[model samples]
Target: MAGLFISFEGIDGSGKSTQAKQLARALEQAGHEVVLTREPGGSQGAEEIRSLVLEGDPDRWSAETELLLFTAARRDHLERLIHPALAADKIVICDRFADSTRIYQGTRSGDLRNMVDQLHDLVIGREPDLTFLIDMDPDTGLSRAKGRGGTEERFEDFGADLQHKMRAGFLELAQQFSDRIRVIDGTRDIDTVAADVLRIAREAVGVAKSDA
Candidate 1:
């Protein structure tokens, strides 16, 4: 809680990883101790759970099951990595956090959304000081994803329909958390996007420190 926690979120091919890395390097160059990590996998145990949830068949785990796995992974990540780093006053740049879980599972409808909220409030109450929501067209994201050809292709296999839904979900989240979520335009070239990310991140980090 003492550190500045930032999370980058977007659809599969929204370049969240690249931008996150760039931001971490930028912050580090600015003399800040930054820890760049990702969700479902940040710590040792979480990485193991990541493989289980990401590599297998998409339907291998039900929505509820996946939620449990993600939440479990998050708990370990926070206890083992995030919380300690933050307590030491390190800048933590997370690729994705609970927002990913909220949108991914929240799409299932009914009480699932409520469940996510309750679980997060009960177990993972913390939120990023700033959230970068890379906004991109689902078509563009899917195309980029296809070009990657990675084994972690389960999410892409869901087709454009799901990607559209996911995009909407993220955008909706940006509005909901607009005070903290900066919806960055992800359609531009890599450097341009990174520049925008760094600018906003610097502003947010500065403001967070000022508020503190």
Candidate 2:
């Protein structure tokens, strides 16, 4: 609450993870204390839950079940890592947050967005002060994601159709929460995108370019 809370969100392979890391590093080098973490896996307990939810078959868990698991992991992550860092006035840059679940489990299968909101409001009441939504073409993002070739293909395995739907869903959510979400064109080169991300982040955190 006292510090800046930032989250990077996007369809898979949209380069959000890379941008999150870069922001954290850049801020740290600028003499700020930074906590760079990710949802469903920031804390040790959450990391365990992450494997359960990310590595299995796409249909291994129903949307309802996956929602509960993700909520649990998020609670643990906040209690263990996010809260304390912010309390100490450190910048918290998370790769992904509840927004992902709102799209992934909320609307991927059915109209569960209401249920997702209720659960989020009940158990995970916090949101990032700033969010970077990396907008990318679904086909391009899916191809990039699958090329990584890891066990966490559960979501990527959902195929291009899901990616397209998710891309639309995220854009809609961005409009819904326009005050906090900054939509960035992720189709550009990495450096260009990162520069935009950093500029916006510095503005949000009140860091001047000269200070950096």
Candidate 3:
């Protein structure tokens, strides 16, 4: 691809979404062409799937089923948005990507990580060139997620135990993909965190500090 691909990932309410937007805006102000999009909803078809997977009951879909749905949505997103944007030499800033599915669905029950990896190899094979994993306290993250009071509570409804597990899983995944994943503390204030995120993003996109 001709463009930089970046993704923001974290447990629910980890402020990754906010950071993704901030990074996008900062990069845009720096005169970079950026496409800020999210998984499971970047394309029209994927958006429909997002409502199905994110807004329903926690038990509405099995881990295996979610893997399929997420893969389908991701395929659409890649074909319709991500690939083209990158081909156009535009920076792609995604709020979440395959890593989210790998952690959420891969470990939702037993060890489906192998299956997730195999399916990803078979379907959605692309990964972000750079990823920002916002590390946060699971307890605080769950509380913040639930307090939002939205229909996307399906994952949040899984409760604190899962949140803790997810936080650990994400950190482990960061280790596994350490070359591309950057871990950032989410406990800091928004501007501080955004400053860190923007600094790293600027570096990855090869924008000199003076240019920004």
lDDT agreement of model 1 with the native: 0.89
RMSD of 3: 2.5
For 51-127, candidate 1 gives per-residue lDDT tens digits of 88877576777788888999999999999999999988889999999999998877743448888889999988899
Question: What TM-scores do the predictions have?
Answer: 0.96, 0.96, 0.96
Q: Write down the lDDT that model 2 would get.
A: 0.92
The residue-level lDDT of candidate 1 at 184 comes to: 93
Candidate 2 clash pair list: none
User: For candidate 3, lDDT tens digit of each residue in 1-212?
Assistant: 68889999999999999999999999899999999999879999999999999988889999999999999999999999999999888899999999999999999899999999999999988989999999999999999998999688899999999999999999999999999999999999999999999988878888422333
Best by lDDT: 3
**Candidate 2 lDDT, tens digit per residue, 30-51?**
8989999997799999999999
For each candidate, the alpha-carbon lDDT, in order, equals: 0.89, 0.92, 0.93
Residue pairs with backbone atoms closer than 3 Å in model 3 (clashes): none
